[model samples]
Target: MTLNWDNCPAVSRSSDVMSGAVVFAGTRVPVSALFENIEGGATIDDFLSWFEGVTKEQVNEVLEFATSSLAPA
Candidate 1:
């Protein structure tokens, strides 16, 4: 399947995609979920436990996408 960033589910802050909320492109798992897990002393294993469908690669991609979105133009 093709990934379309435009259709991806995202939350914005001040019209900036970087400062906004980001959920799974298709699923409802918020990118912040991963951060929340780590902040709560949850390991990678624990994060996967809560979001079985999310992969480590996906988490990385989300961060990368967010970074690019915020990069100075």
Candidate 2:
């Protein structure tokens, strides 16, 4: 199921940004990048080191949002 990212404050989408792909707030880094990097054997620290604008708290919030989405509720 496609997630409703609107409730996640760590991210935003705008026609003016990356063609409206959902990205971390205040940064052009797509949220998908987080998953991709992790899938590619990269740690969160590695991602944070590579992407300067995104913060650990933002990443945590996004993760929390995704995890909550998958809950049995």
Candidate 3:
């Protein structure tokens, strides 16, 4: 199922930002970048280092949101 990011506080989207791509709050970095980096064997720390505008707390929240979305009801 497609995840709805509307309720996730760690991210936001706007017509002015990345052409409305869901990105980490206040940054131009797309949330998809996290998964892409992970799929490419990059660690969380590596992602953070690469995207300085994103915070660890934001990452944690985003990850938690994704996990909770998949949890059995």
For every model shown, what is its TM-score relative to the native structure?
A: 0.51, 0.96, 0.94
**Cα lDDT, model 1, residue 41:** 96
Ranking by lDDT: 2, 3, 1
Models ranked on TM-score? 2, 3, 1
> Any runs in candidate 2 off by more than 4 Å, and if so which?
none
Across residues 6-72, which tens digit of lDDT does each residue of candidate 2 receive? Answer: 9999999999999999999999999999989999999999999999999999999999999999888
Residue 66 lDDT in model 3?
A: 94
Counted clashes in each candidate structure: 0, 0, 0
lDDT of 1 at 33: 80
**Per-residue accuracy of model 1 over 1-73 as CA lDDT, tens digit each:** 2223553334222334444445654445666787678789988777867886777777666657666766778
Over 4 Å off in model 1, which ranges?
A: 1-21, 63-73
Better of 1 and 2 by lDDT: 2
lDDT scores in order: 0.61, 0.97, 0.96
lDDT of 3 by residue, 1-73 (tens): 7789999999999999999999999999999999899999999999999998999999999999999998999
Give candidate 2's TM-score. 0.96
